[model samples]
Target chain A: MRRLSALALALVACGGGGGPTHVVSGVSPPVSAPPAAAPAPAPAPPPSEDASVEVGLGEARLCVRVGGHVHCRASDAHGERPLLEEPAVEGIDDAVSLSVGARHACAVLRDGGVACFGDNAHGQLGAGVGVASSPRALRVKNLASADRVVAGPLHSCARVGGGAVACWGENGEGQTGSSTHYAEAARELVVPTAVAGVSGAASLALSRSVTCALAGAGPVCWGRDTTQQPIQNTPPAAAPWLAGATALAGGGEAVCQATRDGTVACRGSGALVTSMGPVALPPMTSFGVGASHACGLLADRTVRCWGQNYSGQIGRPRSEIGTNVTVPSAVPGLPKIKALAVGGYGACALSLAGELFCWGSYPGAPREGGHEPSIVAIR
Target chain B: MRPTQIAAAVALALAALLDRGARACSCFGPRPALVSPGPDHPAPVTSRVRALVPIHRAAGATVVLRPPGGAPVAVATASRSMGGVDLVELTPSAPLAPDTRYEIALHSPGQYPSTFVFGTFRTGATRDVKAPRIDAIGVAGAHANPGAMSSMCQSADTVVTLDGISVSDPDRDGAEIALGVWIADAAGRVDTKKLPVYWAVPKNGHVQLGRTSICDPRELPLPNAPAVTLGVAAIDESGNTSPVKLVRVALPPARHP
Candidate 1:
């Protein structure tokens, strides 16, 4: 099988277009300023493309494998149409965890550093950072051992080494838990932490009002509890029916747990903003959250997703099947895959099969971050 | 008609007008008691219609028929029942359909087009319209996260199709299904007519739940964070409604699981 090449997105590629950035619902506007007059001018990157994955079913955008890196689309689609492509990131290069929010996204790199992109008026993309076009990563102050990142509409949270969770960005609804405006770095989250027993967990999940974590055979969550996500200093509890899980992801109003048992369990309200319904999946390894849907990794390394299949983040255009595909099903025609991640309206996945594939809208290269000009160094 | 009959009607009218005087102190004279026109009267007999107009103008005075639906008919404005009352007697030129939909407009002097009666009425029907059945129900679209609220819809189209459901008229003699909806939370309540309800896919796709609020009816903001219950029901022409269709959706389980 030909390993699908990774889809790379160069932020500068899609030069700033004056088109109306039509965003739906909670999406905010981009906040980063244009790069200083120097380096190079970014060209117009091609718009993202989507491929049909099922017959009489919706399509999937991102593909991924377990324990592998992920490739994602920089742009997100509106309805069935692709919006941006290979968009840029705002933080560090080596992201450890990634999540999408209402208008921005957050990433945690291996060095306990945080990066952000998309909208920043809420300071969601973080404070400092660089990149030609994509949001460049800015070093968050305070704690440096950040391990996980989760983004909500106006807020972002990270799980640090000591089971302490810190959140910043928009504090409008006190979504950051603390009644403060902004917290630059990793600090003790105001809400109770749910990772008590699991001392050093590798992952954490955040939704609009809640956050969750997985450690050993148990997972825990806290916060406003819209759906489910870990807050801080809480013990990991097993999802109601979910047994043996490896990874987890949280949406604005829903949560999905990818289990070591190979099955994914999704639980939440049936509200329009929430993705409800039981999604049956083939044995899978991991899962990621988009604005409204969740994508999972299959044993075959192919990606399968269910719930709010908007923006083709589930791997295909929802229009391909009318309504949303809320059932865990296959993303057809995808070659071997490794890791998968969903951001706002787009998706990215890396193929252990050696390739990276992305669909929906993101702001970069169509195939393998194309041999673009040398990346600019942003300090 | 005998003079005695005429005298009786006049007396009744006088009595009704006098009754109104006690309730509201207005410059206008007393109101007239409404008496059903007798069979002996001519086909288009004009009778003084007992009415009460505002010290200014009545807000929504309308001439409604007993039954609902039929060929378009006309009403002739006779004499003013009372001075400065702006109340005119209406004479239907044609016999209204028995137990069917009929309408009459209040002759507003130079305002909007003759204002038609809003609700339908049946002449002498026995039963009320039957309520439409509710089928599948669920929420669609993006999930409710922090700032946004979740939405859901109920499917009545299928039942409407199989049963030929139509809007019910309170005055209609027979049956007609009518739709009414309400949403409530720990804080307050909202109605379907108030909240935005969208047509589902396909024809009369019925109604799916939505968060968008419409004009006459609007959604009430969720007060206590995390959850709310939605209720929907249908009424029949007889003024009967089915048990409210109800469902509750919440971000956090009402009870810890």
Candidate 2:
């Protein structure tokens, strides 16, 4: 307490108080402090229950919901921001499940309703067909039983009370599980469209072009493939490679899943990923996938990552980035984690003790800091 | 497109593109530029500020700006503290020509002297009044000839390609132009709303739209409207539209049944 008091006094003396402190765990912005906004280089957010974080695939921004109130911070070319100081999504309280798309985000509220915010270019927000974007979270029309929600680059899907899922936004690749009927209203579905095929879905793994569901029928995938090949639109097809996966996370053109037998299977081009074999990898519980990389949390709470380290998203030290990028390696210096979210080039891990450690930040100069784990104060 | 439609389209495209560029790689801007987008910065720079090009740890960095089809603009380099980050800011020593696009070549000291294409930015009036111009359009997938729209039919789900579509803008770089493709049935019912603007650039003077099922034109209503048509257009920083090219995709006879 005495040490903290001294530090606070020093910060005040240095003019670090009274400005809107967008304090979170992040390296200072690339060029300079943001225009007039205050950023506090403070410690991590204090530990608390019912806290979770979601990072958009390919990472648009970050949002952390604690005790039902959601705080978000987005990075722009303008430099740093007092993220979380201003709630990106106003009135996003009591969210039960959440998912982050490339430029948008959605959440399943405890009331069984779904709400979304951010870019609505393709109508991912589900407010209306022509609604471009939303500053506040808006409720979806005609959806009231979403079990869980998942977001992709151009669309969002919600798993309802049953094993079915409802989707909205761009169907250019039939990602909305249906084709555009060649009408303006059909191009971007303003209301949620029930995803056809596959029922009893246990979980959903969605990327830019691929949407997969793990269920009793094994792993079924739809939408376009990595090479822009159109897959099934209505009835999702079984991915022969993704059989019996327990958990799934994906990004870029790759999909990686963890099995019940403690085996992690990742199917992607050798250019973007490497297998976790030759030497047996420890069993994993859940994992996160980036553009060309992936990270999995072990039952023991340690994290192991593999694939491209172009921006050190693979979690290796700065010096070791180009080395063994395709090799599945362990990310050092992370505590036992509770949840993990991976964007195209970065990854974040929330610890059981309420600290969030993120790496692979490319804010400026191939070094967004946190090439290793950097504490982000979520409060 | 209507005025309201144009506003909405630009708003949607810019919003999504900005969010994407922000989280993608080394972002270049006038006020607070990000450094070192690695060997290749694929994400387009969206800043309209043309005063400062920032580079981090650029003590020995060399900055070069080459305008489109013109001579290189000379710049003086200096170090300054902005927002607590060490920046090697590159300022044009002389007034840059108005309404021009410049390709940037930056070489941080210690790397090879040869500089790769750093990225690009547009310099002109604070509020852009000009629009982008798309000259040509080409497709590389199954489609009925313009003359045989009724007789020739193609699969609705076949992935289509928009190759050799050229887009250029003097007020903004091609990176700033939002290009999109919309599919409409014979009844003129469109599939994608707002054309779904995405990152498009000129490669070898052609808009690199790549391949997409975005033109997955809906299976027509019936025999009366048995064909789907695709229209491609480009929207500029000011939400101005280019000359649209419409390609018709005729479905097989059996598809109607």
Candidate 3:
């Protein structure tokens, strides 16, 4: 039942302009109603509607999408700041979504345009090399409209108006879907370029050394297959299990697809089915894959995570459960979540009430910052 | 045996003895001309002894007072090969008495004559306890590849060459120097293990650089928070450690495909 002091809450309010600020509620003691023997029970209330709040996790920072604006806080630096406060992105507040990379972030405006900020050593900001690092968001060059955008560790890709995919930044491993190898091609592309052989891409997913897209047919991935995983070279047409996949997720060396049948099929580094053995699986609505782990949000609103648990990234204590969680296990003590986001060393869940909770070795967490999930205050 | 045959055998033995003497170990140190005191100090004074050839063993090396006065003292020796030269160093257990003359002797039982004086030295009145100076630190990549972007990368397994280290000792006392490098992450956590480098002396203003790959097991799998700091320290013959010189490098995250 720990409560943040009023002074601490005041500090969280100092950085950003006037807006609806969110605060974490303290755990309340259990209350008991007066016992009236054999009294009739009242009817239960109906379930509340899902809250609309977007949360993005970076290596050392976290941002929340609220009221058409994004507010961010860094672990090392105190206070919060508007993600689009820079002059380059001024007067633009129709932010619909945000994607955070290792050191940078990108936002998709309601007008279908993309603006990025932060580190650009490899032109990840899409503003070219001259603008090495920018605190303000810059419009992605030559990208008139974008339906969706996903930022990876060092690169970024966006789904254009016609479902066309464009990528920029570090191409060392051919993650940009370019035919040329990083050693032979320009290391950093200042502006976005059309991904070769890819059209009508419904969505995009990026991993450490690979990128995959959900196209009309199914999921196709391309990049460095460091471990010779199944998602290497062109699309994966040879696997029949991915024929009717509606969504795709990428990991360090693997890719998973959510099929229309509510089941998930994965390849490279072994599929979740292989880990779960012959047990019956609940219907999955979505998937979140990290560098070495994966999780699925079931239709029942419960989350089941499996794979590497080192640093407690799997929502359990490594010391208590050992290093690897071969099969899916329920994440205890977490409220029913609407979505989940897994990072290289941590994972976060967005509750139905718009509360954000995170676990594992990510920065700014209480205690050891791992072993257990805790509520995060994103004002 | 016949007299002529015996005489020939004696001659052969004498020739073998003379050959061993010819290859006796030769020791060297700071030039005597550089040890003058006061304003005429041509070079810094030092007590370290270096031999051209490796000494047999530490037990066979000894330093004694001149004129055969006090008892000979057994000294410790360490051998290492550097810069195409084999060097054996001699360090006394305790400081030699001031204003005293000393001679270093080497005895390689079966290889060389037992009674050979490697070199002679004179102890100065002043003691050198100041640490060595590290002027600057420079870093570069091991290989020059046209495709490689700026030498540094987001991967923790990047190899870099620290060739621009400039080190100098005021005493000019030791023939070898030890250098250490450490890395610190943004959270102020320092890598427990340090990269160690050894360099041969008589550098004459020439600096010897070493190469090392940056891979710390403790570093998180994610990209470096913002930057990583590298620090280098120099250690002198007198056991004095220099203040660490630091360099900060920005590591942007690796781009995903």
Candidate 4:
């Protein structure tokens, strides 16, 4: 059987002729000098080809895939220079997928190679160095031809060739798939290590303390089980329910899987569902989970989300929509969504036309303004 | 034996076992060995005493310190658990007098009828003149790993580390001294937040403070700031404050490819 792949195309569009446009929204200015020479102008788009863009949310930065390159901006401090403009962020032209964690980000290149930047205190960058952090995209060691990459709060993992998974960074609760107790010593796993007992995996999903992979056998997860929640450190002996799951997604303390039958099974925080009860869900093609909320893209191209709606992450105010949406509700005022990405308290949807619309909150200052879906302009 | 007789015997045995368990007292610390003071053998003086006890059974326990010829000094207690060990720290409202003896007491209502004496320690000759020496101040990026992700959110500050700051005290044990830090950013904003300083027991002779990132509420936000200056001061047990020592750090310029 062909493996199910979360291969949604991210759209990118070049701006009209301009010198060097900088976009700032309560962020700080770039600390490094601008490039000595301007980059070559991007060619105009052909009528038949839509620009592809990939977006990832970090703790305080928003990364957008543009022209096969990834550019990032912060949402809190005041200044507006793209993080990719740094000299250290070279060889990002072939980035195919991007995953952003609390303080770092990783991009899967077209050749299935991986590179990461930002905080490396625990060596999340996978670079064999002692530096606490880096602005450059360091190539992940011993990892090549990765098809999918997911960045957890601290560690990062990638599904490499042969459906094998490799992980690095904090492994306190065995999140890195290493039995060694590193969290006790306050140490970190600096390089990607093969995840034991996991192969033929199609994709990986990470929460605060747990890592789950949709493998041939089923959705296998491991890591710290501090909450005694259904999402335990060890998979149940007999989990027929997980059979034939195509994709896995989670945030905060919850985990949800989309099955081939098009139904969704979620465990952890009950807030991810609606109060009306578990209604029959439409066949889903994609799924995204944030800290307290979850969203799914239907095969019909419509998007629906549930869980916490406090910040209007479900696309409406809590007054209009209740606090706990136990049932999946369609997100209003959105075009045909191609893909979706969820952050700590906010969610963003990429439209078929390559437009990005976000609701709730991203990294930065607290949510002070209205919580509504608004267009985010990217270059 | 009759069923009633057997049941009575089992109840008696269980009650005896619980009584023995309740009477077990496992407590230690206050460090430097609390003992009588002498001119040749002076005791280390501090306004606070930290005691290690069973965390689960310390709910109604109280600690008190009585100075010679003076009313009992007010003691505040705080409890914390680390590495499976629970610690209860007792801090006196005021420092003990120099060259004076103070009796320490622990009282648990149901566990002990009378106050349990923790022994007496005499304070040494006042050394309020010498303040703790600030050895060095070091800063590094916050530790980024999967475990730290739950609490931190994304922001422009993503590229910047939270700036973990470490300070060392040369005179007394690092934990014995109360240290306060002030951070000033390039924007000229000064934050005089009193950060917690933990003594490096295994490392010996060093104290560490601050988090991996400024996102922690206790840390001063220094995102994209080109430079920062930190001021540190040590407050002695006798309420003598040290002169502020300033350390200026020049951060790498923000990157723009």
Candidate 5:
């Protein structure tokens, strides 16, 4: 069985023109003056693309598992930017899976352990609130085994051994499967708490404050949806129209899933951002979601994206960057893909033969780091 | 517990204002008189915050609301950080009963303490459109004698304290006013920036002055200052403000002799 990868983002290939660096948040403006030899190709050798395992994108950074190790590069001055010099994450050796969030990142290890690093202000790092955030990754406590990990802006969750879903971090909207007072300190979860009532989960997706897990009981979701009435700390009703969800991905505005029947279903305020719910697209092998746009990998190895198109993330003409695409439009110029991810403001895909192609904000940010950012540099 | 007049908290506010005395006051009184619960006394109608903020950072204070003889309603409590004085929020498990008297109790520092009663939010509700006015400000510890209403009193060489400035919100008794205060020179110029904005809860319709004096001569080295005066203006949660009242300061008749 092929191990299907998930993380939908905008559609396209690298070098969609240097255009303009449009960062919604985190990526700071070029703080230092351009070095004497700035705006050239990457100073370091390009990543070994053939040996790559998986790729993860987030609010301000990117991560990839290569040669059984995890490496990441981030934007934001106080974020993981310092580690860009040596993108190999400071902790963990045998990382099996990788996931990134707004300002934090985490990976699942071969031994079924989990390590996270980045902002802890909302405890998204699992170090609890007020604990200083460091680039060094730290193991999440109380969990001896985890199958997969998913991280949202202010919180995160992991699939436990028995398929029991556990989550931590901010719970202002009770998004963590637990409730927290509105206070910052009260809302942070230093450790993961098992989300009751969810089991046998095959896929999960987390966004701003909404978390949806596709499990035996169907597609049940919880937390606060900016588009719906908040159902906190309680079992959120399953989306009636979203049964048999085989793959899941979410963005700031919505969550979409690829069902076993080969159709795609999406719901949330993003419907207003673009025409997202119950999209009539062809049978898809998998899909990835970015902040406000999403891309799907068709059985024939083509990519199509729709939704907020600012920065031309949906493969539309650069002139149509700010316009929204209601229809699933094809992302022109791409080879067959094995897996892909969406985050920050763009999308990237790993070709079947192991070549990497990214488009719409390639190598998202701290873009002015002397060397132009392109492929995920797996050292 | 009775609304005992223990002015220590005010002294702390005053001492804190002047970097002066420690808060020597402590009175565990009746539960909060349910006023509109915004971040810290704003408009009273948000469902998100069913809080009693009068506690004002009382250590380990817990607010519980219950129907008389009924089981305590579950509530979520937290200390809301409001720059000046952090306010505690108490979100009851459910909407409070209408026109009904619910008990508001402080579980900590127990004994003879009784829950407070807040029921005016009943009926169709007539909004208090009028901003409460300040009849006057009475000063204590300004020497044993005084002249006319506008006269500045004489004082001793060391400490001068203002118990609490009073306000009249006739629409409701026991009303609390968020007062903006500052020190001015006899010429009536006040450095609003260098002032302490405090709250005063009126009792018996009298100006229960609960703050410290702004006339700490050492702190106010105004060449034109011993004539340093006090400025008090009443502000309602609805962003209403009263005319500024300037009170002349009375320094000790004999200092640095």
Candidate 6:
């Protein structure tokens, strides 16, 4: 039983100002505990709560509404926080989102279209041309609307009706699909069309070119197949290194999938990751990808992340992994996190309470500093 | 319970709680902050700056640039007292002269506190010179059909020298030598001597590549096989030649079955 060191505990405590260190007492033993139940329905009117989601946007400010919109603000040398907000309109309708490249942000909309904003230098924004400053909605032309959208460092994707998937932006290593020629459009992948025969693609795991989809059975990924990170698509036959996956996320060079059996498997860049072992899963619900780390939202509405935190991506440390936290560490003091997003060097979580708490860089903002706000009740 | 036994029991209970807490807390979490190094001196230089920053702030902390054996040239200064964080860009009052040795001293309040960055970078000397000299010869590399490859280098026996003199500098309000390179076969020629590579999806989320998938390397995209050499070159503001670098990769030896 590895325990969080005193320094890690201090850092964690410093990260979140409110809340005493909790010691779970009577909770079911992790060995046989069932995944947490699905979260309750969100409240109306954007949950008069505090900001439940906060991220350290690159030279940008971040804010989120529990079951609502996610916003990022950045200035041009001048001190001004331009509002860049995108709202989620689906049941639990909050479009889980994350930042990519430098200033780009993408969100999954209720209508199944990916809404993107910020720098489009490499056309990474996906919201083709005519810059969208204030979340002006747009969709991929000639592409089916998606049920969810996952944003990578320089590329983005949306799961369409059926098991079909389309991606645009950078495709250096054919991570988007097996296409040989690069096309910057919502191009269809007719052959090997379905991601691992996924009858219903629910989410996308993107790492620049490589994209993995979470289906009913497990996770299936395509593009950029290396030895440590191979691409397999045989059906019925569960993929090696991928099974019981309910949610998936891609960060830096590694990809992590949440298994229904309450554990996680990650590969790429050869970094150590957390294993649930006999621990119970809270039901894989949502996940986000950062530059080199990933975070997931559980059915209980709590948040957990693994991988590097050189810039505080996984908040304050909890175990010996602080110097370079390789495995998943439970974020201290956060309660019932509704949705989550990961960016270059930071992560943000939207709490069911509608209070937006953030950990990592850009911690000077009075209200949105890295901690749960006791005063602001989200929903 | 004895004192030691009681203490041991407490420790065990705490460990159990910690384990449960660890798993319970493993559902989802937050991202980190933006801490990527912007433009800066190399890593070692940055480390030096961090170590020496505390002493420099005695007086208003500032960075003063001085040229080799010349009067102090106040190129850039720190507006605010930085806490040794790496500075992204130092907008000098004027661009430094090319091919000159310059010393950058980050002035903290105390004299010993300041750290000096020393380097000699040549500016646009090559720009003032004529375009890059290209020695294009008949098909010298792999070609199963010698006549075919030779035909590609038709007429022009002499290498074309794309002079940097004609390069334009848009920012300086005029043209600065922006010399590029390309190959021209007898049948066709490149419109511009520039690299065609574009942005692509990040491989592993870092290495920059074209956004699209890779196509057949042999299949040329241009309408005609515009003989393009390997890479391109650019000159600086000063008259410094940017090391006439060539991009024409040597073709593999041709094999005939």
Each candidate's clash count:
109, 17, 4, 42, 16, 81
lDDT of 5 by residue, B170-199 (tens): 664434454545556557876543323333
In the range B85-170, model 6's lDDT, one tens digit per residue, is: 22222334544454443443343343221322222112332222233222221222212232322212111111222222222333
Listed in order, the DockQ scores are 0.01, 0.02, 0.01, 0.02, 0.03, 0.02
Q: Which prediction has more favorable DockQ, 2 or 3?
A: 2
- Ranking of all predicted structures according to TM-score, beginning with the best and ending with the worst: 5, 4, 2, 3, 6, 1
lDDT of 4 at A120: 78
Q: lDDT of each model, Cα atoms only?
A: 0.37, 0.50, 0.49, 0.51, 0.50, 0.37
Residue-level lDDT for B154 in candidate 4: 15
- Candidate with the larger TM-score of 1 and 5: 5
Residue A323 of model 3 has an lDDT of: 70
Q: Model 3, stretches more than 4 Å misplaced?
A: A1-51, A75-92, A130-133, A180-188, A225-241, A260-263, A269-280, B1-257
In angstroms, the error of model 3 at A161 is 1.4
For candidate 6, the per-residue lDDT at A348 reads 57
Report the CAPRI category for model 4.
Answer: incorrect
> In candidate 3, which residue pairs clash?
A154-B254, A154-B255, A155-B255, A175-B257
**Candidate 6 lDDT score at position A270:** 32
Query: What is the Cα root-mean-square deviation between model 3 and the actual structure?
Result: 26.7
TM-score of each: 0.38, 0.51, 0.49, 0.52, 0.54, 0.44
Residue B149 of candidate 4: its Cα lDDT? 29
User: Candidate 5: misplaced stretches above 4 Å?
Assistant: A1-52, A76-85, A186-189, A225-237, A271-277, A320-322, A362-379, B1-257
Task: Give the Å error, residue A195, model 4.
Answer: 0.7
State in Å the error of residue A319, model 2: 2.9
Superposing every Cα of model 5 onto the true structure, what RMSD results?
Answer: 18.1
Model 1 segments more than 4 A misplaced: A1-102, A107-111, A125-136, A171-199, A215-218, A226-246, A259-262, A270-276, A316-320, A361-379, B1-257
lDDT of 1 by residue, A1-379 (tens): 0110011111100000110001111111111112253232223233221111100001112211111122333233332122122233323446544444555545556667666555554455445322211344455545477654555555566667645566665442343443232221111111221233443433455555444554333455544433335422212334443334344455545555544334455554332134355455654434555555556555456767665544454565455643477566566656665445445444445554434455544444233321111111111
lDDT of 6 at A313: 57
Query: Positional deviation of B39 in candidate 4, in angstroms?
Result: 39
